[model samples]
Target: MPTPDTRRALFARGTWPEASRIAAVLRLETVGGALLLVATALALVWANLPGGTYEEVRELHLGPAALGLDLSLEHWAADGLLAIFFFIAGLELKREFVAGDLRDPRAAALPIAAAVGGMAVPALIYVAVVSASPSAPAGAATGWAIPTATDIAFALGVLAVVGSHLPSALRTFLLTLAVVDDLLAITVIAVFYTSDLAPVPLLLALVPLALFTLAVQRRVRTWWVLLPLALLTWGLVHASGIHATVAGVLLGLVVPVVRSQAAGGPDAGPGLAEHFEHRWRPLSAGFAVPVFALLSAGVVIGGAAGLADALSDPVALGVIAGLVVGKPVGILATTFVLAKLTRAELDPSLRWVDVAGVAVLAGMGFTVSLLIGSLAFGQGTPAAEHVTLGVLLGSTAAALLAGVLLLHRNKVYRAIEAEELVDEDEDGIPDVYQR
Candidate 1:
């Protein structure tokens, strides 16, 4: 780390291409998560044993009852800890809207539309399944929304480890699409997953959020002042019965953003947002995500002895279908038909075939998807467990297929083939090299 004065100089300048810099910093969030996936796997497996799940989580002694709101420890974690995740998600959303990929109307349209289609189709399929069997289960019907999400950080983490076998265009496309998918997932959670709110605390929660917004408009740069507000908002929401994660999103939206850069200095107006992300974001994304994965993704190897019985359930089956079949088909089919109909092509450097393969990878929705599932099914049921299995299997299969396709050169990668120095005969083989 640089000296304080030096850092302050850098801070005051704000001349950094902060987006790229933050990208590098935020990369740790994903990489650490990837590193933690193994431990998470072990913990999950251990937890599924008779006493294993019980072993992993330590409950906090909070209110067993509020005036109108009551919460136990798990409720707090699921509702509270996860709110931080959503807050980060909101930050990602705001950044994308401000200067990120979604800033471009034309370039952004395809992914936005594709994400919408991807989310809608999966949800519809799930609803139809539920309608066909009205008595499916309590959590089962609610779980339709779970498969509609795409966890960008986890997916991109896998891609980063695999390196540049994939074209830049495909990566950008997948990232933009995943962000849109995340937004949709959040709305579904806030609207569909919540129960009757205790208005007193809910109103109280908004107080600091409103003040926080005002502070940003007033250009208050220090993040320390917001700590008390963060606590108050969190407590208010916890009592409010809305998923506390909504607070994260609200705070993210109010984060300070500058209109433009200083003439030639590095110090500019990203002060609070930049500082918060630098410290808190890495902790949340790096540590929090993995902890969540360990807590949620643990599959009981032996505990699942009767899993086949559970797997046969329609809720489970629909989740498998939605992420495995529905996501890719929805994403690729829409993109393909739209591009062909409109005669719209991707950047000449990208192959539609390659993009299709990445679309498969985009279906890997581990973290946020599980968060929604946890919210949808607060108490573990056979159906909830099975749905989790479907997400794992489906996401794994999709990621593997996409990775394999992207790892090596494929003749089907039409766009890549477009740029070549080959003199080919009618049979499409280079005449000079063929003989």
Candidate 2:
């Protein structure tokens, strides 16, 4: 261990910046997760209350009407604020692809496969359920992708709380899987959800995107220059009928992950990508996401009968089944099959049960699911409301189930940790033998 002064100097020089950055992200996400829960709860209560205040607030529109941007408060939150969250996600994705575990094919294979399985299974299940149900709406098929996403912040937050004693590898696996899940979700939003695509604005978006990429490539870290470019690109993308959040992801991808000579030499510090992530992650997690949740999660549960009706709706039932059942079944089944095929065992510290618990945790599809639900059925419509109810109910169930399972897993991990410590003290004698 270093002396206090040495530690201070190292910190000042950013010697352990990666560890610091990771810790900062984890802390912010945990708090954000808690805030998200609060916002969702508040929305639920406010919407369910006697007053119609929630709908009024959510429907309040403010923006330039001339540019066709006079969107409601809910749209602004979903489309505008969520871009920031996606930007941070894009940065994380780029970092992972460039320098993190995802850079290696061997390390990436399992999570990528699991993510694919996780997405595909839920979608298939949703489509099958919706199609089989005669009561399903005409366009219920579009909502099939709603439950395909895994909320990274919420999932990690739950893991942090319930699996504090679990191996770091488990968290790593979850993060990787979530990242891939987000990528697929983004792609689906871009390809399937876009309507009335204006080619001109879409092409115009390339200009700002290119300039942004060039600036970052040249080590230009000026906020004024980059922010305008990002906004402009987002505007163009928004106008082009694709989801505007995709612009954030593209902007993030363009940023160079590796440091250049202009960025204070090879050993100078973290790259621009890392710097941007550190600066924006707090904004994304603490503000953008929570605000989005407050806006989007407010659904009028009507009453017990209303909730029952929503749950009984085929679309709602499909989302619930997709997230709570299909998600885990797909993820766990894929992992097990891959392990068997490759003859690759899990890490010694982990078990199949732990993976199952995590798979269940992955089913907490809140943010992206809500977004997709809105895109599938017009926001504030009865169908959309039912989708929201399904998402809330499904995600809540997943969280509670995962919490119980992972909490027990955490206890087991703690006991194993104690056994290892005891073994170390007993000259390598096994804990069972010593006992």
Candidate 3:
């Protein structure tokens, strides 16, 4: 290991603990992504059936109306179940910024810049396409945020499937980039999307949020103490009309990432955030997101004509263009500019082509894309349906394109691996490590 005076290289493998944690998170996300796909497929089939049964089920209302809790099943899926997804996102974000590779400003710079560019270019491209298209919906501009998100689970799942030989650094880069992207998406939702916001409920939401924060900070792990406060906070935020998912992020932000002194000091061991992430990630990934997908992805395609019409719609076209073209362009351009400005270089073992492949993979926007689409165009509107199709098509195109590129690169890495193995057989150490 290098002396304390020597700085570790950017995108180095990181600590063993960090690597292990990343691997675990990727495994969870990979499985979650598979479930998300299955749910989407099921929803599509249910939606296209002759009876309109899926729509009726989605429209069915439940819960207590006294607290504005009674809502269509679709609304609950969007507003409530997704809070769990966002909560996990929040936990991951805080952990990264606080104790992960992102705590180093030098390491954080590239991914932060790339995430901003990824979001900006997509939004701009969407606006441009919508503005230029005559057949765009009246409020299509609102959906500019649709392609700004990178679904961590879907992208990670695709990578896990295709990139066995890929370098660990590339995976780290993608994870950091996507986490930052999620932060931006959450900001857009809270600031640009909120309407009819109620100050009383919004202010009142702080009470439970604070209590929950305190509980986590004190290392209170009991489910009974924490779960009710979390639910109440979510409910009040929903009442305030600031998307309930925002509450999840807020709650996540407040959870302490470092261990308290009584627990053996800051670096003694994993803190509550990690513990909470471990507990809730399964619920979010396995049940919450797939259920949301079941409820939201059920857009009835009226055969070939309907498919043609959706693809023709300017809104849909914009979303597809944004994901397939704008995302990679933005990420690559930003990374290039940042490297030039800082006079920094990628890790010695990696190449610009490797970065290129990950940039393209960043285009796979799914979960938050669909969420923003629904919020932009009212749920169940024709525009919303078009948005769903665009997201589906755009994400699929990105996945296919990225897969081809990464698979080619994977073969190159595999050859490198073979060479290293040969060297190891001769000297009991890989040539690169021997260097």
True lDDT of residue 203, candidate 2? 98
Show the lowest summed lDDT stretch of 10 residues, model 2.
426-435
lDDT for each residue of candidate 1 in 87-197, tens digit (9 for 90 to 100): 777777777787777888767777787798788777778777766875577656778887788877767776665534445777788878988887887778778878987
Tens digit of lDDT per residue, candidate 3, span 1-435?
Answer: 776434334223445566556546634757888999999999999999998899999999999999899999999999999998899889889999999868988888888898999999999999999999887768889999999999998998889888899888888889999999999999999999999999999999999999998888777878899999999999999999899999999888888898665556644566889878876787788788999999999897899999998989999999999999999999999989999999566655567888888888999998999999999998999999999999999999999999999999999888877866435556565444411
Q: Each prediction's TM-score against the native?
A: 0.81, 0.90, 0.90
Q: For residues 1-435, write the lDDT of model 2, one tens digit per residue.
A: 899899979976879998666647645657778988998999888888887998999899999998879999999998999999899889889999999879987777777888999999999999999999999989899998999999999999999888879889889889999998999999999999999999999999999999999999877888899999999999999999999999989998888888654455643567889888877887788778888999899888768888888988999999999999999999998988988898555655567888889999999999999999999998889999999999999999999999999999898878867766544345764543211
**Cα RMSDs of all predictions?**
6.0, 5.5, 8.5
TM-score of 2: 0.90
- Over 4 Å off in model 2, which ranges? 1-27, 260-267, 343-345, 421-435
Rank order by lDDT, top first?
A: 2, 3, 1
Model 3, position 62, has a per-residue lDDT of 99
How many clashing pairs per prediction, in order?
12, 0, 0
